[model samples]
Target: MKQRYHVLLCLLGVIGCLLFFPRDLSSALTFTPQALYDLTASRTGQAAAKPVPFVSSGFAGFLDENGRPQYVEKIRYGAAVSSMGIINYDSVSTKLVMRNRDGEIQVAIETRGYPFFLKERLLIISTDRLRLKEYTTDGDLLWSATFPSPVTACAAAGNRFLIGLLNGNFLYLNEAGEPLYSFTPPEGRIKVAYGAAMDAASEASLVVAGIDPQTAYLLEERNGELNSIESFPLGSDLRRNLLVSSLHGGRFAIEQEQGLLVVDRTNLRRRYFSIPGRLLSVQGHPESNLLSALSQDDSDRFVSMIGSESNYRGRLRLAGYGPGTSILWSGNRFIILVDGHVLVYRLELI
Candidate 1:
């Protein structure tokens, strides 16, 4: 039943791109779309930033800016591809294959775990879920830690990372893997933590915990101590985990029922924006107060840009196929991955 739920949540295929190019730029430049593979048979995956990462059933790799595959490899257990490189683990050999941007084998490490990227660092959660290892992008181990209970959720920013365990313990750790502070949300029927997010500035952190009645808490760090500034009740059931992110301008956003609750941490002001479908991915611009979200309901998909005060700026209708889709905003570039294909757009405002 758990595997069935995973499959149901993963099969969101995108078929076309959002033509967001302005009229003037459309005449001066041409935007081309590329299909890297046929992912109709593929089950679950996601996309990352530049040299975008694409993963299907048994294959994984990264694509260059032009939507061309830089490297592609077959895998068995798990794979984590970032703008930095690729980390693939083969259970049979009990080894990890690390590759560079150009698909060159840089190094190989022996480990049995699921490799993933946390912010700019590489981390692997042990198969037993009791241990965590952080490694540099080059496949060198930086630090590792053991937890008394299973790690249920994690998030990272700037130089700090937060890890939440099944026992309701949340540990805030610095770059050296040293714990700075620990917290546990007060009162809950079930203690499991579902998700967490922290901004790059380390000013605020968000966590959603419990089962029967999940709750979202916004926390502030001051004088080396973490304090809960606000708390909100969340829906009892969720198809996807909470979409919690620390946005620009001292603001944070949380995915509520059918809209997003945007709050300013400094003044405790709030705004809400209603999204049309199942929210897939959200990316916030670091330099500006621009927020982009991707959503899909059945065969209809959309990419919307939001400004301050939950103001709707613009939206583009996207068409696509398969079982998964995601969006990433880096500077003025908007990247969308549908099924197994990658589409990148360079936006210029007039």
Candidate 2:
């Protein structure tokens, strides 16, 4: 009986080693909410700088460094921003040129007739209705033209502008808006266009996501030819209300009916996670691989920052992923940018 008891004890020791030893050995780490909150708070006290304002209808206006309103001048039609921050406007000209921060006129060429801004690129919708027009940053029109269908969305990717259209078409244009190469997508699929990016590892290659009747296609550009690298069907929940926001490099974030999905553009692998509360607004960082979402909890509002894979793991494992999310910043200062004017919030986060 003593010998039997010894054997049982040995077995229990082995089981404990298997269960607990590996976790300690792996050195897995996580982030704490307190740390994150502290980091964000530190950024707040450092004198708020006024952001450039582009105002239109309602209360659409930007604030200067002194908190003065800077309204968009000569606004003929109301402009709408896409989920990815693309601004779309309706006008008669085919070729439109607008000034940038450097005071240089950046020309936008449209094949179809649509005049829209994607990222920083002004896209011409249809080639048939193409018209050329020059404008100053102060909304002065210097020149105007009419062009044709197959209008494309343009965005500033690195140094060059990537132009894409609805019909699986693409083009690379210089800063002067001169076309470098015309790109065509594969058969039977329409290029979503908004989520295109240049591969981080290879600037010569481009990554773009498109959708067919049933599946999403992730394609890679090699020497101008688009090769299908990954494809997957949209989740049933996502398919119901598929709204894609920002696409970073090869990864894209989408707001689905179920929650948010972060997809790897190269291999089509994905990670699915959801915020506890309803998402009010979402934005992506331009230089970093992070996503910040604004959500409201009960009566309070909060900002949640989800960094890259490493930052996410750090937060979840170390700090403990809790209800809702780790509040990055919150205040009763309800400020909602809708239809132009900033709607103030009555709730405050103490």
Candidate 3:
């Protein structure tokens, strides 16, 4: 009888101890965010500072055949509609120029969303019409094609090109400008595409998306045909914002309120991250989900490095990022556009 009474007391005491000292569910879990950039590190750059020297203010930049970045500004004839262009860089020896029989061709090329570069070819796509001209680095016109609707954006691989149209039409063409596959988006869905990304590894197939609640479509190139592999819905959260393309590889990013909505192009694997400030613009890795986000923290500006899994890694406070200030990520370099100066920083993860 005494032993039974003692056992009961010990059990009651143990139950009371458990009730008083509960375990935390989350505290036992282990996870570490990717990285944080070293605060003391800074990058260097060059100044493209010079006079506008042109009648019109159409300035753009592109990578050369040798993988060097070159800037082009439109040079205009005095009060005429003719558009001349000059390569405004210190190293003018490797500069490629475009000229026509009468004068300069009236076309300027720039990426509408992402900084996609082709190693060998440059596409001169008309912003106002349904035309595309492929040019070699030496300024040779290789091929040109006209579409049924106005071309919205263009993405290119080696000899393959994917063209998005304003009418929700997608045309997949070869190096010779022959139409391989044509796709029209769903009847009730968004047909007018905002951006396009071509995955060179996926047989030069493409992923395209637009604004109606933001859905992505993976168009696979199979047996010389374009097939709609999947249509991944991005939900209603991405509605009505200015949808731009930031697709690199298996992932694509969309601009959101204070961060980026990065998703896997194949599986719709969503990763949304919020930087600690109002997002101004974003650039990221073309192969991974590493994003260089530029945001305004009150009156100051800062750049934060987001990881592949959408974790806040590190941040760098920018000195003079303001209105009309632009930034570009060239894989290993961060190019900041400050008026006439181009600040280039070798991206280091610290």
TM-score for predicted model 2 compared with the true structure: 0.47
lDDT of 3 by residue, 1-350 (tens): 69545544543453354346432212232112112121112322332232111111223433222213333343222111111233322221222344321234433333221112343355544445677776553455678788888877677666677777777777778889989777776733455665666655645344445555556666667786667776765543333333344456665565565666676766657787776566666677655556777777656677677765645656656543454455555545555443333444443433
Global lDDT of model 2: 0.41
lDDT of 2 by residue, 1-350 (tens): 68545544543443355345322211332221110001111112222243443332332223333332333223444443221122234456544444332223443433225445444433443435234332333444433433233333434555555555545566656555566666555433544443344433333333243454334445455785546566555553211223444355667665543356677665657876665455544556555555656554455444555666433421112122123222111221212232222222122112
State the RMSD for candidate 2. Answer: 16.2
Compare the candidates by TM-score and give the number of the best one.
Answer: 1
Candidate 2 local lDDT, residue 199: 38
**Between 1 and 3, whose TM-score is larger?**
1
Q: Please report the candidate that would top lDDT against the real structure.
A: 1
Considering summed lDDT, which 10 consecutive residues are worst modelled in model 2? 33-42
RMSD, one per candidate, in order: 7.1, 16.2, 18.0
Q: Give the TM-score of candidate 1.
A: 0.77
All candidates' lDDT scores? 0.69, 0.41, 0.51
**Which portions of model 1 miss their true places by more than 4 Å?**
1-60, 63-69, 72-77, 90-93, 235-240
| Cα-lDDT of candidate 1 | 0.69
